[model samples]
Target: MTISAFQDYLNEHRDRLLADLVEACSIPSVSGQMDACEQMAAWVEARLQRLGASVTRWETEGGPPIIWGVLGEGSASILSYSHYDVQPADPLDLWQSPPFEPSVREGKLYARGVSDDKGDLMARIHAVEMYQALHGTLPLVFKFFVEGEEEVGSPHLAPVAQAHADELKSDGCLWEAGEVDEHGRYTMYLGVKGIQYLELRVRGADTDLHSAYAPMVINPAWRLVQALNTIKAPDDRITIDGFMEHVRPPTPAEEALVERIPFDGQALRSRWGLRSWLNDMDDREALRQFVFAPTCTICGLRSGFIDAGTKTVLPSQAFVKLDFRLVPDLTPELVVELLRAHLDRRGFHDIEIVPLSSLSSSKADPESPFVRKVIAVATEVYGHEPVVYPSHGGSGPMYPLASGLGMDSVTVGVGYTGSNLHAPNENIRLEDYFNNVLFLARLLQSYAGA
Candidate 1:
């Protein structure tokens, strides 16, 4: 079909397209909520089938099903990946509306997965539908693998990727989740950093003791604080042994791009309600470290206290959640090994190291021809210069795409900066939603024209 015809079709059915997206978003497909996982997958499968593609629900013994759909017949196929699931909605009271209700207010559609993933997935589907309605066929071959476990660390995706490597083969694959910059500039990202998430626990007394016995019984919370101190210094530099050993220095090209990137540290701090970054990380250094350096973060902590007022009780156990963001060439396994060694060497072998999730890093060359196509299309749609990220700070299951399928992945979507991703009041602007539909349509048409 022709691009103009497809655009006309999309505009003619704009309301219908928006309604379909809303219906899909209405499904509460939180992967953590196991029962809803299957329902969401079924909805996606049906939607793809309605779009004239053959659908398959690839099943795992205990994991949620992986929905797949295919269209057209060509050697060059685009593999589009998205997640049907979303993070659990906690702190419910903070939401302006019920998360699952899917309401529109002030030009924003409020829902848990609206911007994070479901919106992006719907855009591609709508694009395909528009082209089919116009020309009775797609511009290129297409395949979609919508996963159900992204919010929960994507534990089952590796096995799924390995098992269906040949079936999922394609010339290029787009990562599921992404967002525009604070200045309303469209940005395309290639690959993501690796991650090692672990929880540390310290034990002291056998049971909780009263305040009067504070001097006699040891405090596990204090011990946890002390251990955290050993892990990261006041300046945020990780003191863990061998943590920085595998860091690959930025290439001359990457360094030059870093210099070109317009990073406003003061603006970022104001957005996050912070006075300054840790250790006075100014604009240039902050952007450089965000892209290149590894990190150690304490996500959460638990200890003893009172319900309403202060209760001085020496807690028996204290727990802390730690995450390490890794750069290229550093696997999660190696980070864990180094963490264990660091603790053992520090004479704190008693502290338990419980792993939560580990993902290896993934990256693609920003200067590649395929990457330029992505940037060009994004700019055409958004009417702004698209920022090309060599690699983002977040972690995803993109390693297999880069290593197993031998294809670079790019993340481009309509999510705005204030979408409150993975948090309450999550939303996407109405304009972005419509723009994304146009972007996907133009992207598919670009290949045909090329």
Candidate 2:
């Protein structure tokens, strides 16, 4: 099918397609809300049904359902991975309108999961309808692997993937979504960093003690701080014993890709109300560090007397939530091993380490044929060359479905720079949403040789 034909079909059904998106986004499928997730999954299943696809609902003991559907007909098959679950629409008062009630203002659609994933998910679904209407049935096998628990680390996805490994086999995968940068350039990511989220705890006396006995009574808060110091230096280096030894430096090709990425550090600093980046790194260095560096961050901390009024007492418990972003060679299990050893070697065995969630790092060959094809089609459809990232700094469950399944994946979505993902006032540009529909349709045509 011609691009204009696709464009005309989109133009004809623009309102209806957008209404479908709004309807999908209307479901408050916040991760962990199984009922809402089921509703959203059913919404997706019905669309697949309309396309005459056979759908399967994979359910486990405690996690949300994994919706799998297959449609189209061709020698080649492609997998599209997305999640109906979204981050909680927290701090509710910050939203101009209700989080689930999608509203359009200033050419942008605002709602809680709109830009993050729902928009991308519906875009792919609508693409099938658009293609089938303009052409006949799709010229390629279209597979949908929409899961319901991505926001909470996708803890169940790994096992679900192994259980249904045969059904997931595909040529390549289109990851959740890509972005349109501030310069109006469409961007794609080949891989994502892995993550290890855990918590550290320390204890002092059995209960709160009067500060007057401070000479003898231990403060767990103070003890926790001392232990945390051993992990990272003031220079921001991860000083955990032997932790840096596991990091794998970027390849020459990856470095070349980073060099092509656009950076505006001053603008960022202005926007964030910061004088400079950590250690005063320049734009290029900051960007490189973002994509290549593994981070040890303290996400949250809780101790005694955090309330407004001061209390002169020592508490018995203290804990801190830690998030470690991993790079190549840094598996979540490996991190746990190294951390346990580090704390033990430092004679801080009393400090407890609680493992929360783990995700393995995954990457694909940027020069792969499937990747090259997607990029070419993106450039053709978006009228701009797509900026290719060798690996995104963010963490995701892409490992289980992409590299874990021996398939390359690319992230090209209906998101933009101001999408406000995982934050209040999340939104997506209507133009980008419509363009994504056209882009996915063309991608199918290119893959199927239609």
Candidate 3:
């Protein structure tokens, strides 16, 4: 179980791993694209079977199946979570190459799902393969759980995990999508924020009316804007009735962890061409908000006359897509209840609240044995101390699968700062991919022996 043996195996099989990744990425498994998702699921099932895993495809009510597999037998077991489905590669013109065609350029592999979760998935599989090759048997029991609906907020993940809790329970879970920071330091996140995505719709008239009728007719667009304005104040505080009451401030230890996190606000401001952050907060305050504060964002807005030219017509209906990033103690169900009550109380009862998708937040103790093991292995593999984030700002289904199952989860991946996740030209460095194989191998060895 030495590092050199793992490295030797990776060196010998690097090309094969890359080829497998390319094949996996070639499938256009966009979240809602059932045909492609099924194709990708079949590919995963075949691959896992080839690696001697017992595979099961769990069918969702209306979504793609979840590919679950178990391999090897050991005293300790570990669950690896990743998703095969990717975000739709829209705005195709932005891509330098086709989204599904995996291409290697400048030592990086570029594809729609290459870096987000597919690459991570492939790396873990390769790690298991390499470990078995050298040790004659896997160091620990390994479980692979790859879902196809993560890009759509994993609407059914909670129920699926609950139903299969017995099978998914493990000593620790390895989450998807970790990355190297801009400073070339590998980073790990213990948990992720929760999200509540919903849309507010309003209607005023039966159909479009001439602009001249605006003086008499109530405009739904204007009404929607007024209602949106009430949810957040000009000071960037979420004024959704009772929303702030659920946002608990970071504990003293959490604050100390935040202080340790390296942040360069100036670099971010320069990259985004911004003069300052919201409310011009100082570095510590900004970092605190970045990791702790909940957000109210308008993801999309729609109404009549939104094309190239203005159609001088009054809009009959309006809708706004909103996402609320929740902190600890704030559940998605609570968000919907509070928002509906808030809108109704503000006399905008006509505005409909349609809950799109949601999942609760997840957090792990940084000092937990599982997290400490990850930090130690990452440090050894990267040859430097890894940047540790108590919790990532993004929302994911980590809660139900990890913390909810009474397991600690840590994220690790083959991405860098410029991986362009969920955007065009998503990619990961080949070196990082190979290095992660070694990292996972060592983690498995260490965990098994512990």
lDDT of 1 by residue, 1-450 (tens): 445665677668878877887898888888777789889999999999988889998887687988999996655578898989988878899999999898989988999899878999998898777666655677578888888988877888888888889888777787776677778777777778999999998888788788687787778888778878888887888888877778888777667667867777888789789987777777788888888888888898999884897876778889999889988767889888888898888788878889888999887776666667777888777787677667788888888755457787889676888899989999998878777777787787775553
Clashes of each: 0, 1, 0
The residue ranges of model 1 lying beyond 4 angstroms of the native Cα positions read 1-4, 90-98, 208-226, 303-315, 448-450
lDDT of 1 at 320: 93
What TM-score number comes out for model 1?
A: 0.90
CA lDDT for candidate 2: 0.90
lDDT of 3 at 267: 93
Q: Comparing candidate 1 with candidate 3, which one achieves the higher TM-score?
A: 3
Q: What digit string (tens of lDDT, one per residue) describes model 2 on residues 238-317?
A: 99888899999998878888898877789889999999899988889999988889999999999887788889988888
| Cα lDDT tens digits for candidate 3, 6-125 | 888888878888999999999999999999999999999999999999999999999999999999887789999999999999889999999999999999999999998899999999
List candidate 2 stretches off by more than 4 Å: none
lDDT of each: 0.82, 0.90, 0.90
Weakest 10 consecutive residues, lDDT, candidate 1?
1-10
Descending-TM-score candidate ranking:
2, 3, 1
